[model samples]
Target chain A: MKIIVSLFTFLICQLYTLAQVNQASMYGLDTSFLNYNTCELGAIHEYFSYHAKYPESTMSLLKRVQDSVVSHPIALSKNGFITFRFTVNCQGKASHFKLYLLDENYAETIFDKTLVLFLYDFIKGLNGWKIIKDKSGQHILNYNSYFSFQIKDGKIISVAP
Target chain B: MVKLYLWLLSLCLFCFNNSNASAQEVVVSKIDCLDSKWQESAEQGLFHAQYATGYMSEEWQSHCDSLLHICPNFSYIWEMKAMPHIKGGIYDFASLNKAVSINPNRQLPYRAFMKCIFSKDYYGALLDLDSAEQLVHGGGIMDHSFSFYKGISYLSIGKADSAVLYLQKDVAEQSKRMGLGNEHYNSLFYLGLAHLYAQQTKQAERYLLASIKAYSKFPEPNYYLGILYLQKNERLKAKTYFQMAQSALNNGYNMNEDNNIYVDYPFQISAVEIEQVLKE
Candidate 1:
């Protein structure tokens, strides 16, 4: 019994150490929860600092959106602004690809599919995120991102970085 | 429980060693433009394999033998390089500038503009917005403002006349396209306010009333209409408009309502701006 316990303890420690292995940064997200409540969702969304060191530019993410709006001008959709939150685990794996949120009274429609596809494909095609770890260097964090779009009357007027 | 814990621990140890050995590192190898691959991808067209690289795209005879993983393109590589510091869906200024410098056609500035707007960095957004405008013109010319952002950015920067020029164009074009939709009402409403701030009361009143006609539930036009009546010393009319404004604010719902664009745009009215007159 003692030997087994000792072995188990050793295994646990080994596992913990592995989780701490430093990873080179990469583009990913932390989608730990599937049905997050509103408050939880808001908090998760706010977790990322708007401006941080070595920051990413929005150019690659939002250009096509701005172009669409300019090419075909419309207004805000019935849903107001549709926000899609993509979460990836620290291992550079996609945890949640299509987590979408919308205004209080809006209904989902076919156009939303297009929006989701664009975002998913864009994210999947992206490469070269270095690595992510907490201050303690513990491999216990996930990266997150939220992209929002405002479409109305079949017009995609605005998209956010 | 003991076995499971032990298994987890062993797995963790193995994983730790594995990660150390397989850690992705930036390849700082040099590229020789004289190489055939380099000329083909980097010079011929903006091909992915030529100018960009990642640790994963490690080709033995990589472009100029840089040992660099060929990237999708310069734009993607630049964006990926700047991805470390990003949070909250907003981009930092430095990275934004870099992205634009590398690829003028990419949407870096516009992304920065949208980020700035959310972060309430109006001045920063103006700079990005202008960059976006310039880039668009570089490739193709647009007769209208960059889809209301120019006008909104101007208004946020407190340049009402400049805003009026853009907003007026948006209001006219958008109104024609949507036929009094919420967006149309919103443009009209802002144009009216822009006129009001510029002290063009007549223009302000006309647009404000027009905005109100287009969207009855929108509280802004009513609130501003009240201010307009008060400016004319029509106390009874002003008082009526104010009551209507208040009623609109308390009302059930108009999914398409307009409010201030900054601090409280298309949502909540600025009590401070309106209260000054109410105090009278």
Candidate 2:
């Protein structure tokens, strides 16, 4: 069991980037590049660089999503987390969305196509992202952010860090 | 000219990589940050590693990795390296296992804490906590008793009976040590949740109210109180509690757990839930 877990961890680390690439290809959906109207033209900063924040509380945003996004029960057989990694630019516009799905055990997996697409569209449509200022509060910065949805029995359980 | 540019770029990368390490080398002597359990070299490595640029950064991780290379048996470095992975929602048990193997008394509870809270692997947490209980004497980690986390894990995994047992033990121990009404608010909150799950509504309400009294701005107890009221078909009371929960959240009150910034706690509620309940 230990050996298997080690091997799994090794594979996950080695193929982490590849998994993102494959997610798009496997689903025939290119969530990789989104054309945002308000993105600044410069180097995209790391998330930890400026410690950017969302415009509203993450819980509020998630609550709104759970109430509205999953309009009907999805009969998908899988239960896991759907995480979207994206960039929010200086102008508070998010782009470059990448999706990663993992099971309760944290192993990578896929969910229903309709469900995944619905979530992808919902995240892409989300606005009012906030660009955090530097420590001196002078410069506006772009940063990467992750949005993850915990799912159980085809229902949206919660949003997480 | 092109070769000179390439050379300069390589030098810049090298400098960037070693910037934090160089800082460590300069100040490691004056810091006085040493863990007596490990060797001096390992302690120094950990101290220096802590001075790395930022957590989850390549430089910071590489600094830890380099330290591990020097002192492979150092559990702190392994734990440090595993943190980013855990917070990022990747459960790297191998590194955590390595840490536990080296120092079970110190790392087991930590691993259990991570499993219970961050990874939401309740069963796994219980296993580690059980082992930690065997190895260590009476103690706590991350500011709560081991039994507190065990209770939480059992509650999370739907074993309300076990959760209530452990949580009650935690409350008794805490009350005995710190005095009544002074146990950790989370303990009361989870006790309420466990009772609620077990259909023991009166007990649930008692503990939930105690939790609220302990920390009024805590949204979770208010939210669960809303659920309890709803279950009792008290719509107006439920709405009021839900509104309170919503208001608390809007005011930026959240679970005060140390790692709440990195992961959501079990039974955490959101504004939408409150709003939905209000609408109903």
Candidate 3:
């Protein structure tokens, strides 16, 4: 009788462990849910610092403007990534900005007109960047960047490296 | 007394067995739901695969490849694969044609419609849409996606009246069924285009704005906004929208190429026809 009882308890514990394993493997734990605070602005600043060292020639300026837009400025408190592409003309005028948020949770919650407008204004302000002309002599700049952010304890954290 | 005890023991064993079976059934059901979740994840992966750059990490590619291997006839996976090809300026007529051929009775018509649109063969696309409509009618395979594409195809062929009719119907029904996703936004977009083509600028503006509201990330609304601005002689605004469209297209957004839709008006464009346009 004692052995039987011990065996039953062992079976129950085994089943519980199996259930947990299934749950963990099935729905990935949200790592961004953990508390971690880091600022994306530091990385952005570093990028710009290195970029600023490039010659202010037409091509270099065009690249600088493109880099600025691609480096996402805003961070969210979730595992999210955004990509933006834009062009700065030969005269250092930013135009044709496109931003896309690829995070499902962020898309549902954070992407809104207010945020989009803010991003647009930010890009437009960098109108002083240089541009490179294509073979057709059309001055255009293009780039893409990925940024992830998380918020913990009511404070925003940048988790993108 | 021994006989009575044996009977009681049998009864208890029977009841215990039944309860255990019920518990097992519940466990099975939970397992099924878990399996369904995996399938959903696979579907999402396929959807994103369409926009994946050619330089996909080995891990991501293997994950998607495993899903495709398990569900070879999954039409969405094939469709997703076709998209990156189109975006990267690689035309895979064979894969797209196969996708439609394999699932003619399914949502393959939508894929066929996209192929025809990308190729700038509006007439061919309309024919495919007609076939798709027939299949739906034959067996009651009612999906708002078909009507959405149908409307766009009509608009591309310069059939503004038909476009409006189909898209308005789609919008009404989709809204009722709460089908407001990418397809819903598209229906709204083509409806706006139909209005613009019909010279109803006020109505066009309303629908276009509604489309933008529905899915701001969609480039179609912004593209039409540019056109609307051009019509109103707001060149600067128009230029901004056009630039937005161009940027969106380059960054993995699929553009409908029916009727040679171009970021810059009067300039012919196709997903893979960028090289030709650039040359010109």
Candidate 4:
């Protein structure tokens, strides 16, 4: 059984600034701009590499997530990755699904609508992203999360943070 | 007379046995939040439960005994045990050294933040608070306090802009945490002071006055209000606020009731500054 190491580390810095500066005009993340959650990037991958589920309390849930990843089989090229970015609204429901197929350097590549549908459906199925609202209580601040997959042949080999 | 003496002796013996039976009953009772379960739990090696009970108890000796019974090698216990000392304004580095050695994720940042503040390491305090914030799972009292201290530490280091940034965020977060109508008076007061230091007079006045309006008995806001009016060249209004601050000198800035430790940081220093201004 392949172990899927997921960091679930979605950088929310863009939301941190835009939430305060211009809440009304903010949108989902773009690949062009840099992500600040990069601080834990290297350590997170290495930490999860050997250690799968952690902190004891969330072990069952994480174990279940990893189990599901292995169960679902996906077709892919020799190398590259598939990514899905979504906006988890103030209610914690994942929405506004945006799919991306990228090369090793992370440049976006075009994919068929069916492949996009497959990724979107999977990301929309996720249930645990934390939602935080602005102080005014009138608007919902959006936090971004990603579900990234490393593909080998017709199955998933590993997962990105 | 001999018969009466013998009867009295028998009654005394009966009463002694009755009290001993009562003590036995107390010993066998189920331990909960009340009574002296902490010592028992500690002796049983229930370390986490012992830590929790010691944390909430009034008797320090029993708590200290419980702390001692634990294996001091785990820094989490040392950190938990150190809470009372830190709260009472006494800093003990032995326990802190043990804690710093382990650097346990959950409790370390919170205690280390206190340690940094004790050492007057404002920048270090900021970094510890950031680490605590990232690792903290929920919106607990520590999270709110970290937000408050983040601002205060920046202000202490004379970084008014950065101070204002965190203080504003803290006030907003506190207000939300306290519910819609409730406001964090001391936090708002500091936010106003931060704004004043940052040269944003209008926002300063708004927040300071809001704090005074929230709790008129609080002296810091009144004293700072005086400073605010003085900046505007309104001597009479400044004098009014200064007198108000003087009257409330004994009424120190209230301590945060919601945090783990009972800490007090009054704004009495402002009184000296006001006096100097008045004399000039």
Candidate 5:
């Protein structure tokens, strides 16, 4: 009985440590919620920082890929928005991916695990991100970037900002 | 040496006093309300909020929340707090709706603009803009007339006929205000798009040419005109416009709107898309 109690306490401590891993940054960024990976390097700026951009204008290409890749399941008729938030380092590599799902009213919601994982992998595989440049066209900086997808009846209707 | 130190100290004091006076002036010049005491508090709150490093930072949110605690009915504070969330796609509607409830005339146009641009809620945006028009006698907001935004919102939701009506009104109003042939390039571009989608190809061609004439480097209208020409089997004209669009995009010309930093405008095209058309 004594040995079993000690084993239970050990398990509880492990679980508590796992829960505490997600802490807020100085900027109050929720660092670990639904994060696919947590390997951010150096300091990062927000996507809305001055003159940030992707390497090229290929968002329509991305939309085309999404339309072709996501196979619709009849059971997955949920309509909402899925936001993928991540950071691109100064070298333009993306990491620290996070996901948030919301209904039309902007309330938090859930999605199918298969759909979520597919999106996670899709965002993770995206490359050729560009580092933000200052107005003078000098000084490269890392920044966070995000894109949201509007889904209707298991199909992506549009992608935004 | 002692005399030089004393002079330096006096200069420092003068500079500090001057800066402090300017800070106070900034607050006073920006805020004015009927109640003097409330106005003072509001100004101080705004001054402190402005010191935060980034608008989307939690520090900014907390400062806005603290000010709201004291002046719960402050509509501008609610609007300011909602901005970062909207841009980030966090999508909290309570704060923005609260602002609209408090001061409809001042806040409704702003809410409509955000809904149309950031959230892509076309129906919701139309409702808010309609309210704003009734209250403010059809004034503009965020550098666009209500008819201009309504036109875009209608086009977004596939209502081409309504888009044409409002866009025509916008063109007439803007031409009356800014003189003939001086309407905004965007108004003309969108009006052209509406005509194209409504199957009026000749009107589309006229306004699209007008858009490119107004702003030579504009890319979207060029690409659409290429499509229109391609459909008519005018491959040579289509290729010229496609190359023009590609060249403009390569030179970093884009939808030159102020809010595009936060969101892509509806129907905005890209360099890759233009290239694809050229290949076709």
Candidate 6:
């Protein structure tokens, strides 16, 4: 009887330990955290690689446009990331680009019109190519690229490589 | 004399029990009668008032009064009041806020959000939508409804891309579960709008047509079709679509009004733009 009671107690302790481990794993995940990590890494790689290869020629137009426009500073902790999805049209122009996963402040506070217009101008200067049919019968090169960005403290920290 | 007193006491007990039972039966009967009458009168007055003044009748006001007298905190009475305000185009943030305060757990927020949209307060509507979404987070029918409104709110704010994300999410997650019908129609309509705003013209046309096919009586698809035609520079076709939209609204087939419901950009293209397109 003593041995049987000891075995039962052992089994209960094991179950309790297993439950704790499971709960701990789940506690690490949330909608915001997961989105931040995935989007941040992807955007950093893409933006860094593109900026390196093309250098001044490709992004100069975007810089000019950004300078022309009035922009508010966006601040975020460097600890997290967000995933964005956007369309780059045939002209290497970004259209319909948006941050799908955003921090609460970015999502709720950023005006939609300001975001879209900024994206439109920035994307227009990207150096990429998408084939779209023009008024002529032949396909022509367009600068349409859609991708994500990892932004931290008003800086492009990372992009999809 | 002691025996006589005992007999009198027993007689009194018997009479008291009989009277109490009779009184209980009478109370039950009166309650049942009151319940049925109140419901019928309230429903009738609500319907008539909605039809006559584009609002609820003060005459039907008696039904609500009667109901409140009996059950002061009834949620349905407040909902009935909301219907008229919504229909009469007088639904404001204050009225809806009052309704929500009265019954936080009920579907008052949903109704109130609609009124907010009608009143052209997209920001207020979105705040209500956010609360409603949180309230119904477990992906039920109400969740689907809330998501649809959320998508609409995004669209109104000119975040077509965001609108598409939410609308498509609703379609993928909720529409399939709910099956193909009214919910499906609503999903398609919003999805079509998303595509249109994204400049996916062909896809927008297809989805909008499908929405109209799903519900022939719905006016939203027709209105959007007009916008689509305008985009394509097909002036005559756009005019026809606009006329169809107007006719549908006039015939009372349109469910939601308040033209600003879908207004997104700060500088909306004037109705004159439509007329100019038609003239061309």
Q: Please write out the lDDT profile of model 3 over residues A32-70, one tens digit for every residue.
A: 211232211111111121222111222222233345534
Worst 10 residues of 4 chain B by lDDT: B259-268
Q: Write the per-residue lDDT of candidate 4 for residues B237-259, one digit (tens) a residue.
A: 99898877766754444333343
Could you give candidate 5's fraction of true interface contacts? 0.34
- What C-alpha lDDT does candidate 6 achieve relative to the native structure? 0.48
Q: What is candidate 1's lDDT per residue for B1-280, written digit by digit as tens?
A: 4344333323333333344333222111233324455434432222343244322222212331221133323443344333322223222333444556767666555454434355334455566667776677522112224645667667755688998887787776665766655446667787888888778999999888888887787777888889888889998899787777766756732325221111123223533334545677
Specify the CAPRI tier of model 3: incorrect
Backbone clash count for every predicted candidate, in the order shown: 35, 0, 3, 0, 0, 24
The per-model DockQ list reads 0.06, 0.20, 0.02, 0.01, 0.25, 0.01
Ordered by DockQ, highest first, the candidates read 5, 2, 1, 3, 6, 4
Q: Output the lDDT of residue B223, model 6.
A: 72
Task: Name the better of 4 and 6 by lDDT.
Answer: 4
Q: Which pairs of residues clash in candidate 4, taking residues 3 or more apart in a chain or in different chains?
A: none
Superposed by TM-score, candidate 3 places the C-alpha of residue A33 at a distance from the truth, in angstroms, of: 46
Off by over 4 Å in 6: A1-161, B1-55, B92-98, B138-144, B173-175, B178-183, B215-275
TM-score for chain A in each prediction: 0.45, 0.70, 0.34, 0.46, 0.62, 0.32
**A65-153, model 4: which lDDT tens digit per residue?**
44665655533444444555444455555544444554432233444444445555555566655434346865545544444454444
Which digits, one per residue and each the tens of the lDDT, describe model 3 over residues B120-190? Answer: 33455567677877777622122345566667667755688888887787787766777555445656777
Assign candidate 1 its CAPRI class: incorrect
Model-by-model lDDT, in order?
A: 0.49, 0.72, 0.46, 0.51, 0.72, 0.48
**CA deviation > 4 Å runs, candidate 2:** A1-38, A41-83, A90-94, A97-140, A147-159, B1-52, B137-139
Candidate 5 chain B weakest ten by summed lDDT = B5-14
Candidate 6: tens digits of C-alpha lDDT, residues A1-161: 99999999999787532201111122221212223222111111122112222222212322344454445543333322233333333334343333333332222122233443344445445654333443574643222122323344444433321
Residue A93 local lDDT, model 3 = 41
